[model samples]
Target: KQAMDFYDRALKLASTIPELQFPLMTYLGKGNALVRVGRVDEAKRVLDEALAVAEGDSAYGYEAELLLQLGLIADQQKDTARALALLARATNLAQKAGGNRIVAEIALETGRIQRQASRPSEAESTLRAGIDVARHMAERLLLPRLLGDLADLQVSNSRYAEARALLEEASDLLEGLLTNASSPWVRSRIIDSMDGIFLARVRLEGAQGQNASRLFAVLEQARGRAMSELVSARDSSNPAELRAGERKIAALQLKLLRTTDRSARQRLLDEIFRAEEELAPAATESFIRTRASRRKPVTLPELQRQLRADEVFLEFALAEPHSYALIATNHSARIHRLAGRADIRKTITA
Candidate 1:
C-alpha cells in the first residue's frame, strides 16, 4: 500500500532526524503501518523499539498504545494467550494514565478475544465494562461499535430484547455522527445491518401487544434525513477537553475540602462550579465557544422531570471520606453511602 510505503520511507530516515520529538510516535506509526502490510517480523521489531522508548517515559498512555498495537499483531499471529496478556497490561496502564478512550477500545478488544477463546461470561463482563466507560466518557466514535459488539453477543445468548435496545441506541448514535461528516453510503451500510434488528424488535413488540409502528417510524425518519446538510456544525470539545475540565474541578474540590479558611474555600468552590458548568451541557454547540455562563447545574425538579416513569437514575459521586450514590426516581430522591471501595467493587462484580 502507498501509505505503508510512505511510512517505510519515513521510518528509514527517522533515525537521522536528530531534532525529531516523540520518536516513539514515529516508531509506533511505522510499526502500525508495517503490521497493516503483513510485515509481521519488521513490525514486531519496530513496535518493540517503541515500547522500549515508552517504558523510559513517564507517560504511560504511549506505553499502553504501543502494547495495544503489539497485542493486535499477536492476535493476528494466532498467539491468543500472549495477545490477551499484552492487552490486559495495556488496559491497566490506560486506566492509570486516564486514557478513557484507549481503555474502552482495549476492553472491547479484550472482550472479543475472550469470546474467541470460548469464555462467554468474561466476554460479556468485559464488553459491558467497555460500554459503560465509552458512554460515561461520551466517546461517540467507540460507543456505537462497542454497543454493536455487545448486542451481537446478546443475540447469541438469545437476549433479544436487550439486544434490540442496544442496537437501536447504537443506530441512533451512528446516524447522528454520520449526519455530521460522513458519506450517505456509510449510513446505508449501517441501516442495512440495523434493518434486521428492527425486524426483530417489531416481532417482539407485536408479541407483547405493544405498538411497534412508532419504532419503525422513528427509524425511517432517521434514515430519511437529507444526505447533504450544506453547512457545518462541529463539536470541538472532545473527551480530552472535558477530561481537562473534570481534572480542574476535582483538584479545586479537593483543595476546598482541605482548606480551613472560608474565603479560600469559597474561591475554590467557585472555580470548581465554573468548570462543572462548562461541561454540563448534554448537547454542545460547535459554532460557539463553551463558557460557564452557557450552562447551570440541574436542579432536583429538572432531574425528576427528566426521568421516565419506570426508570430510576443512580448517580455516583466519589468524595472525601465517603462515596455517595444519589438515587432519583420519578418523584423521589435519596442518597446512599457506599460502604467502601472494596465493597463497591465486590458489589459490582457480584
Candidate 2:
C-alpha cells in the first residue's frame, strides 16, 4: 500500500514536472517491487504503461529495459515463444544503444529460453558468447549468473563433469561477491547451484559403487545442512532467503531419496505414505486406503522381458542379490527346479 501511494505521488510529480527523469525510474522501481511481491500481472501492466511512455518519447534506452522486463514476465508466464521474441528485440535495441550490460542480459535470457525448449546446443553457444562479452567488459556481477546458466545447460545435456567444473567456478565467484555484499538472492543461487553439483556427484558415485559409502555420507551431511538452513529461513526477515531455503530443502530431499539404499528407501517411502494417510483424513474426508505397493514380482521369464525393455539394466541386475534375491523370494519350488533345467540348456548351447 505504501509503495503504491509513493508510486502514485511520483507519477503525479512527474506529470507536473514533465522535464524530469523521475517518471521512468519511478515506474521501473514500482514494477520491480510489484514483481517481488508476487503481483506479476500488475507488474506487467505497470511496465506496459512505462513502455508506452518511453516508446512514445523515443526513449530508446528505457524502452529496452522495459522490453527486457516484459520478456522476463513472459518467461514467468511460460510463454517461451513470446519471451524469446521480446528478448531478441531487447538485444537488438540494447546493442544499437551501445548498452553491453543489457545485451548480455538479453543473451542470458535467450540462452535460458533455448535450454527450456530442449535446445542445449544452442543454449551453450549463446550463453558462452554472452559470458565472453561480459568477461571482456569486466561485468563482474553478470558473469557468475551466465556461468551458472551455462552449467545448467551442461547438466541438462548429461555432461555432468563439465557442469560440475563450471558450477565450481561460479561458486567461487559468488562467494567472493557475497563477502562484500548482503544479497540473499545471490547467496541462495550460489548455494542451490552448489547443491546441484553435489547431487550429481552423489548419483555418479552411487552408480559406480566406488567410494559409495563416503559419497552417501557426504550427501547426508549436505542434506542436514540444507534442512537446517530451511528451518532458519522460516524466521528470516528476507523473503528471498526463505524462498531459497525452501528450494534447497526440496532439492536435498529428492537427492537423498535417489541415493538411499532399498531398505532405507522403503522406510522413507513408508514414512511419507503414512504421513499422507494421517493428513488425508483431516484435510479431506473421502480418502481411501490400501495396502502398501511393491514392485511387480519378476519371474525368470519376466527378467528376460525387463532385459529387453531396458538393456542397460542387464549389466547391473544380472549380477548379485538383485538377480538371485527376487528368484529366491518370489518363485515356487517348481520354478526353482526349472531354473536348473534352464541352466543346463544354456550350458549345452554354449
User: TM-score for every candidate vs. truth?
Assistant: 0.53, 0.53
Best by lDDT: 1
| Model 2 clash number | 0
Clashes of each: 0, 0
Off by over 4 Å in 1: 1-19, 182-350
lDDT of each: 0.69, 0.63
Q: Could you tell me how far off, in angstroms, the CA of residue 35 lies in candidate 1 after the best superposition?
A: 2.8
lDDT, candidate 2, 97-200, per-residue tens: 87888888888889978888887887888899899889888776677778777776665567767766776676576556544433346557656655544544
- CA error at residue 350 for candidate 1, angstroms: 51
What's the distance in Å from true for residue 13, model 1? 5.4
- Candidate 1 structure quality by residue, lDDT tens digits, 1-350: 77767766776776578686556666777887787777889989988877887787666898899899899899999999999999999999999999999999999889989888988898999999998999999987678777877876776677778977887888788666654534434545655545544444333332333332333343334333321121222334456766677678788888888899999988887887778788766224322232211222245566578889999876553422244555668787655655555677768899
Candidate 2 segments whose C-alpha is farther than 4 A from its true place: 33-42, 178-350
lDDT of 1 at 34: 81
